[model samples]
Target: MGNTLKSVYDAKDNLKDYHVRAALQEDKGKGTTLMSWGLQDFTEKGDHYISVISGLVVRYGKGNSQIDETYIVKLSAPQVTKALRDMVAQGNKKEILFYRELLPAMNSELKKVGLNPLLTPQCLYANQDSENSVLILRDLCSRNFRKFPGKSCLDISHTRLILQELARFHSSSLLLKAAQGPQFVAKYDFLDKEWYNVTEDAIAFFITLFDGNIENGVAILKVLEGDKRTIRWLQTIKHNVYKILEEMMKERHSLHHCVARGLSGYDEYGNPIEAILLDFQIVRRASLVTDLHLLLNISVSGTDRKNNLENFLQLYYSSFKQVFDAAGLQVPFQFHELFQEYENKIMFGTLWALAVIPMIVSGGEPSEWASSHHRAASEEATGKQRESIDSKISSKHGELRARFLPIFDELIDQGIIH
Candidate 1:
């Protein structure tokens, strides 16, 4: 084993030699020795110290009958800066809680409706400690699961599959809540807090991405500052974004209202197959439209999103309705009503795009933009970092500008923004 994997195994006293031998004996009816193991790192080079993700493939079995199993391990980052330790600790806690508690409850609901369980990797072990947190899960790649490319825009067919799966995710939460009651929902109340770390500095960072030119940035900031409604909304979000997100979550009964994934493949007909949702670190109970808006705006190309916006919304609603009907639940909102709800939630998409597009387009790493203390400071360090982020945004100004201009225009035209 590599040093990291060895460190992980060593950190947990339960994984000592005798226990491994006993477990192997239990699995194969005789003691088997671990033949060999290899590790591959999957951790992204980001600034935050959430955790390090790695794949560990092990060969073990009784003599002459060896087998290989691949597992993904999540371990807390080593030597993290004090500024980000709490956020990292919280993320680790939530993910461990998600796998240990939430997944089983959710799968139980899916089984009741005779549907397959949610598409998350199977968790083998989870332990939470601020200093030594670790989660081991089935490696989806071992099951032929592929992640959607992060650097490219999603095509229409891929977009459709994502929408369908998102609908099922939201529908599943509603079904679970309806069947089990608020107490069942309350078990996931850990998600009641604001998951996304949006802050004023983040907002300011994104504002610099608009129009790519200083003149356009100045104009947009002027409009944003001068508009009373916009000002109030930002102020409200700054103070109570999590509470607002909690209310939205309660309203929709959504399970994974954040970045999620599952296995992806194509059918024989070449159509995209539905993907399962995974990664619950930042999962929240929020507006169903929140997921839809973020995915459509960030993943799909601007022109395709513009052309198919209404169709995609309808598709999401239809999928949601179908799942509810299958579970013998009434579709709570009419199509027009849902459309209005979508309109009301347009700000989420706008805000998310503004905050996310710069990173996506410029390939910038996440920083302490989510930190309140960082936001409060106007030091030379913050100024230098802001300039670096702006320079990165300026590098991809044309592409980023194209993607966002139309989105802003529509928000303005619809009277969603002043």
Candidate 2:
């Protein structure tokens, strides 16, 4: 539980930001818990704070949840620091902005629209001076499911529900923008937020983290890094991963994909259910197709990938186009054209995943992540925080090659990846 903070910082690197000023020690109040095993990769290190893990908690609703009224609760935590106290003495905008302004604003909007299913946390509290911040919100351990990086594959039913809702959510936002105007729209803006705690320094940070192998991922990144034709493609594009998602929503071509996404009984149950969108961390504005492409590129099961590329791609396009026709929005580009663009970017995902995925695959024993913090208390820990270096190591590059190469092969066959 104590070491959880380290794991969180390891994946995110941002938590360590405020942790700089050491507060000897103070009793931080009890927090909440979210789902631990969202994805099954042994390499992916998850948030700490788990005590005991029992695989996936597949059953949805259970006892009364304590986090938020709108969504089922899972894991949560709070951090207190001496620096935070001094800041309270100084009065900082960073304090009120996150605690007072952002979350409450989102909650108010969701309530007004009568849309309560969005699992985003309602803001809890942030002390301006102490820099002490506590985010009290609902966690989605049992309710939400996570789909991780894989190539072309049939969308799983749980993920499909999320994808459909993603379209609807974007449409709703656009509709709200139409009715309320741009000023009203800015309140819900997640545009400026950082993802995976990756900021501009991430490129350099990667250099430090990978040491030797940074070149491997860099090779792919430099493909555009030097291609001044695209300007600072990775530099710019990587930063706006969230906005790019909204772009996907904007480029959405059809509602049929959303409808059909709901049709498949692809989850644990054989019945269709609304997609459960996990990880609101990267939720933001983009062309609708961007989400489709990201979802296509990042999630998807390999078994499904190998067996169903053609049909899956067909389903994605047909259903997506159906929705757009109803909305009177021309798809940004033809599906084939989109594939060509994606083919060029396939290595982007591969390279990034290469660095992280091995850690996930070899992360350690599959267990429940009982809290939102990072490391579980019961496990061994040292320094900031790190998974026990695996006894049987897994090479991240190798796993990526296995997963990505097949897709690259297909793209080559289809003449997509140039």
Give one digit per residue, the lDDT tens place, for model 2 in 1-418: 1123333222232222222111101112333233122212122234222211112111122245533222221122222222222322222233235335443444344455554533333333333223223222222334543323322233465454545455544544444444456575366443433222233343333233333223222343233232332223333344344343333344322211211111122347645554443323234344444455445444554455557545555555564454445446665457687455554445444333334333334443222111212223343432112222222232434444544334334434554333
Displacement of residue 163 (Cα, Å) in model 1 is 1.2
Query: Alpha-carbon error at 342 in model 1, in Å?
Result: 1.6
What is candidate 1's lDDT per residue for 1-418, written digit by digit as tens? 0022223333333223443333334445565677766556553333123455666666796667889776766666543233344554566677778788877877787788778777667776677654457676767775556666665678888888778877877787778777778686577777764323434433343333221222223233343333445444344445343344444445544665555333476666656676756556767666677788778776777789889988998998898888777778789778887778777777666666655554555543434223223333356644555565556555665676566555666666787556
Candidate 2, residue 336: lDDT: 87
Q: What is the Cα root-mean-square deviation between model 2 and the actual structure?
A: 12.3
TM-score of each: 0.76, 0.47
Model 2 / residue 133 / CA error / Å: 5.4
Measured with C-alpha atoms, the lDDT of residue 378 in candidate 1 is 52
Which numbered prediction scores highest in lDDT against the true structure? 1
Among all windows of ten consecutive residues in candidate 2, which has the lowest summed lDDT?
19-28
Candidate 1's C-alpha runs over 4 A off are 1-36, 42-49, 78-83, 193-252, 260-263, 267-271, 368-376
Error of 2 at 314 (Å): 4.5
